[model samples]
Target chain A: MLIKYSVKTALTGLITNKSRSILTILGIVIAIAAIVLIVSIGQGAKDLILQQIQGLGSKTIVVIPGREPEGPSDFVNVFLDSLKEKDYKLLKNKNNVPGAEDIMPLVISSVKLSYFDETYQATILGGGDDEINNLMARIFDIFPDRGSFFTPQDVSSRASVIVIGDNVREELFGESINPLGEKIKINGRNFRVIGILPSKGQVSFFNFDDMVLAPYTTAQQYILGRKYFDRIIVVAKSEKVIARTVSDIEITLRSSHGITDPDKDDFFVETQADLVERVGFITNILTLFLVTIAAISLLVGGIGIMNIMLVSVTERTKEIGLRKAVGATNKDILRQFLLESVLLTAIGGIVGIALGVALSFVVSLILTYSLGLNWEFTFPLSAAALGLGVSAAVGLVFGIYPARQAAKKTPIDALRYE
Target chain B: MHLIEVKDLEKTYYIDSVQTPALRGVSFKIKEGEFVAIVGPSGSGKSTLLHVLGFLDRHTAGEYHFDGKTINDYSEEEIARVRNKEMGFIFQTFNLLPRTTVLENVKLPLLYSGVKESLWEKKARQVIDSVGLSHRLHHESSQLSGGEIQRVAIARALVNNPRIIFADEPTGNLDSKSGKVIMELIQKLNNDGHTVILITHETYTAKHAERLIRLSDGAIKEDAPVDHRLVAADHFTK
Candidate 1:
């Protein structure tokens, strides 16, 4: 039979039983929709993370006081105090690390802040000296919406001064009240809020809206009572010199800690490029896992198609016999049925792709408006194509047996079939 | 050479490995353009003989030749081609595809024929018109009366312009008046120089044909020409 007529016949057959056809393809539709939704959302998340990492500046490198964590269990190493004052001082020297532009020793801890009866738990970020403090501000793109950052005099004299995030300011003082120069009690010591930060939801891994910033000297001596630092942030003079600056910082830290072997180094360095790659790998793996799970539905969907096709063949036995008597060959019968199944699944795939895209877009909108994240709606074209291709393949694989069963019917027996 | 010739044809049905014979050594020869009826009571194997003659089923032990070629002489594809080009079938149930228009039902055979797509509708319309169903060309089969449905089935069988047409109790399911009309239509097809093979249990209906082959108990009891054939046109108009 001509392919055109075969398609017409198949379409007529499917259309004659519209409800059954629709119900038959439901599995395929849901499966493809899930795959598309997962891949699109995964791509969106990866893009958001990469964009945030890029916001940290390509020339900036972070040296954490731990060996590179390989898994969740190794995360405890992050709290080690390997990056101390001496190591920070060594990295700051121009002769020791020539490519370094600015280096800041970082101390991070959760602290409770209270102003009168209002109390808020806020993350504390401490940086050394005025220049280091300025570099921290530039790296995080954070500046006070009101008042100013504490000066170098405050750092040297270990003044009890603090910079508060938007949320922290809202919590300690009501929105109507001016919070600058108001003293907030922290760990039994009174610290004056010298700056109020603008609300920035999340940058990299930190939510700047819920943090408190102060000089490392006062935080370490009065608040934390620790002599060691949690991390050291380094800025390369140019993007091209980031690699050299990272090596220089590593060499200076390793020598300052009296480490001889490179494998025995107590700290690990991370550049923005490394963080982007790691994020991509993690997201890709997550997307692949979800896609695999979605494929099980496709398998079930294919079986559903096969089951429906078989039932259709049996129910239309007389029709098949009539077609045979009218001179349709076995191959023609097979082609007609196979085309019916493939067309069914391909339609499901298209509808699924549309549904998945619409759903993900709605979800991204929710994340952006309600949750206040910079979430983007992404249409994963590759996933759409793959979904379409896989659905068709599912049709072909599952449709063959039923089509063969249809083709194997002898005209006399089929015509006599009740 | 005869258009269809069979000798010592045998067909056995194996149900759960038990042998049950449907046709026992049936033999017959039909010439071109002859109107022959294989008439028998129920379970007389006349239907089985018609099935083997029409190439709708294979005879297990037989020499059955159609157009001077044995069934094995043609490949599976060639057999389908021969069936498409040379034979047409009318079932007892009319078998017009439900929910399909009269024109589309007649056009079904042409879809499987070697005819061009551009000429399918034209050929189908001509045959449907010949059956006097031109007024109901767009009507669905389910909407047609029993007599009209049979006419549509006849149109479908004639659409491919086959050399031989087989009617398996063409008027079996109709009232007497409609039956007379259908019998008249089949007789008219025979008069138009198409070879006709009719299967029927009613001797009164079998008399419409010029020759009759009586079958009983899986064998042919008699093969003879009719002395007083019933002319269907004399009894029915339109």
Candidate 2:
């Protein structure tokens, strides 16, 4: 028979039994939709983790105190013994090393701050005049205008000053007025508010927007009555230079602390990429976990397609016989059934991709409005391609046996069938 | 020239190894432009003979020839090709493909013969109109009356302009008036120099054929030209 006739006949045959065709396409739709939705969720999660990692800090290295040996734990206080106040001073003052641009000292102290109606017990960071320079690279992230961090001169004057987190501003001043130059008590002592940050949120175990900043000199003189600054931060020239700078800092700290063995070192130096990769790894594991579950739904959907195609083959057995009797080649019969499957899956794949994109957009919209954080709906093209490819392959893989059975039927027996 | 020759054709149907011979030593020959009808009661192997003649089913043991060449050694595909090229079939049930238009069904034989669709279209329409189905060209087989459906089958059979058209009870399901129209159409095609072979149990239908052959127990018991009385009766009844 002519191919056009085969196509026309098969197409109208589907239309003649519209309900069955719709149900068959629905099976393919569900498979494609599951694939697309799973991949979208996976991509969305990666974006979320990347955003969170960026929120932590850009190109700034974290130097956590490394773990100490178990035996000396009771007496050693190794966190205190390995590095000291002079280490922070050295990093702050030094400039000869390559890949190292600037370092700043951070002194953390838990203090209670009270605004007229509300009080918050927040971690206070006290540092030096260079402390303002220390934050220059980090603060550039918020990318604001009209206000910046306090000046170095303001810090060197031993000024009792402050910079507030975004939430802290809301808690203390409401939305009506700027809190700059207002006085808030830190442990019952008043400090001048120099600048309010640009609402940057929590980062790597600390909420910068919710806390306070003061001059290290004044913090020692009036608050802690101590001169030793706690943690030292080093900002590299750029991300490409961070690894070498971290190693340089490692060597500098080891020599400064008189540590001979690398494993026995008391501090850990890591770049922003290291942090991103760690978080990315966790999210990747989560994506795999979620997609595996989604695969089950796709598998069931594929089986449903196979089942329906089998039923169709059974229904069309006599038709197949008739065509074969009329001089249709076996290949012709195979193409007919295979084309039916491909058409069903292709339609389903398109509809599923559209629905998945719409669903993800709705989810992101809800998150932005309700959670107050923008979670972008990311529909990656690869996800859509995967949906289409997987569904079509499923159709072919599952549509074969029944098609063969139909082709193998003899015309004599088929015609004899009532 | 003889178009078809058959001798000692045998077909055995196996019902769990209990062989029932459907054809036993059946023999016949058809000349060019011959219009012959084979009539026999049920179980007399007339349908089996048609199937064998059409290359639809293989005979268990037989010598069958077409155009002076023995077809027993022809491959199944070659037989099918010959069937497609040299002969056409009409079923008792007017075996037009359901869900297809009159045009599509009529174009079927030419499609199998690989005639270009443009030629198939023109010729199919001409044949369909010749069979008096031009008004129903686009109608599906299900929409057709029994007589109309048979004409559609005849149109399909004649589309290829085959050497012979083999019909099995072409008008059995039609009313007497419609049966007469169908028989008259077949007779007209045969008179126009197209060979035709019909397998039917009705003597009334058999009268339309110039030659009548009777089969009993898978063999031809009698073969002769129709007597004048039967021909007159056939003409007067219609």
Candidate 3:
């Protein structure tokens, strides 16, 4: 019965005072829209970052040497301090682990190159033939381009043959040069380009499409004199071998380095899947922060609704009195006013949802076409329900007080009200 | 038994620091089926007395009986229930709900009484038609003329089939002809065995009542009954 009267009264009020009711509801609409839009954008950013992290490939792992702040450094540091070329001999032959079909150490350094009077600068990476083999499947997954990789003999003999990325060729050769077999000078040493690599996009601060690769022996023996490898890349045989393979690799590498403490181990082991989960975690934190701020703004909107409803009650005091005189009870008065509030909130929620979806859609489209990213638009039902439900709850909580006050008004005083 | 009886009723009004007395030791009685008019000048407390008699306002101190039950012990809800069940009220301004249609205004009491939904429209229409407002039953209060609006208020008052129809200056806003028409309508209702209690300042209006009670300075000044046999039925013929 309250709903009926409320629907009728609200409908009449909406019709009678079109501009005022719309203006009042506009505040709630904007607040809800801002809430949904901010959360959606935050969620979109999180999802995008997570997707990029996953695109690094989940089967791969990275190891970083633990930093020494309070305790003594690992044997790798001592080896670097003593300057011995024999440490490489200890690590070279230990290949038969449970999961590792191959493991290769890399030489990474920045090199400035001049090609046919054109200078292009890039990071130069060097590793064994097995290093190239490990990346073959990953490159095919993302790029699937044309070129043969390095071989065991080419790396073992310390061949001067080099592989250049597509962007480096474009930047240095420019317009008329396909320098697949051209010799490029790095630190005054000449190396012939063997194969032009396909574009592999970019990760973090480095452009994968602008790097140069050579035999690890060539880099250590000719370009840089340091014997210790800069990094190591590995590939497990299959998904089933991952867990056993990782432990076997860790144990083998630990004994080879003469380290017993896992915390004080020189190298760190991380997988691409771990990186993806970290990205997801960070996105959730960011979304949580953004939603907290939006909720505060929604609180202000609720206050606005409460204030307006109070004013409406005061302005309609005489009407209330008249109704009471005609035999309307307190409950009837409360129901009518409360219904108006719910209607206002529900309508605002719908408009806000539309705005949020539209804005997020536009951003996703721009990201996909203009920025050329694999930006995915993820819409979860939980997020939508949270947005719609909060708006309605705000309505009920803020609206009930004024409704109660309106209901409690005495018929005598209300009738006499001006 | 008297339809309404009040004795030594006192009412006080406090605006701020000063206490203004409106009804002091007022006493009056209206028998069943009596058409009584309580008259006074502006500020004479006649309206206040009528309000107390209608249960719309409570006296600060009073001994009042409706039919036979003492009203002092009733709670606000109980009083309102009694008002809904026994008394019908009409104000000078025709206090019909402004935003509602004439039909809805008349049906207001039935809604309050929790009457069956099916009988609401039937009873509302019956009373509205009986008040000769059948043509304007659906018109909004704001859209009705002064006389039409008073008729709507009367229809509302009769809709619940109350024991007494209370009118406080019911025709004060209407023209003399319309006021006379309204008074005659009240007389017809009173003759049909419903008690009618009117509070008015117009002497001409009071002449239409069978009994007159004059109030002065918050108390009853006179209680008298005038014989309508000596009064000419037609004004032009008299």
Give the candidate order by descending lDDT.
1, 2, 3
Ten residues in sequence with the least summed lDDT for candidate 1 chain B: B229-238
The TM-score between candidate 1 and the true structure equals: 0.91
Query: What would the per-residue lDDT of candidate 1 be over residues B1-238, giving only the tens digit for each residue?
Result: 8999999999999999999899999888899999999998999998888888887899899899999989889888987887788998988998878789999999999989988999999999888887788899999987899999999998889888889999999889999999998888889888889999999999889999999999999999999998799986633224
* Per-residue lDDT of A359 in model 2: 77
What is the lDDT of every predicted structure here? 0.89, 0.74, 0.73
Model 3, span A166-224: residue lDDT tens? 78888988759767668999878889887777776655324567888777888888788
Tens digits of per-residue lDDT, candidate 2, A271-386, equal: 67877887777777876787678767767767777787788878777777656555666677777787676666677788888887777777778877897764778775898888
Q: Clash pairs of candidate 3?
A: A63-A268
Ranking by DockQ: 1, 2, 3
- Model 2, range B1-238, lDDT digits (tens) per residue? 5898988889888999999999998888889999899999998999888887777777898798878888767865666567677777787776677788999888776766778877988999899878767789889988888888888888877877888888899888889998888887888778779898989999888988889999998988999987651332233122
Return model 1's CA RMSD, one decimal: 3.0
DockQ for candidate 1, C-alpha atoms: 0.73
**lDDT at residue B152 of model 1 (Cα atoms):** 92
Q: Model 2 chain A — which ten-residue stretch has the worst lDDT?
A: A137-146
1 versus 2: better TM-score goes to:
1
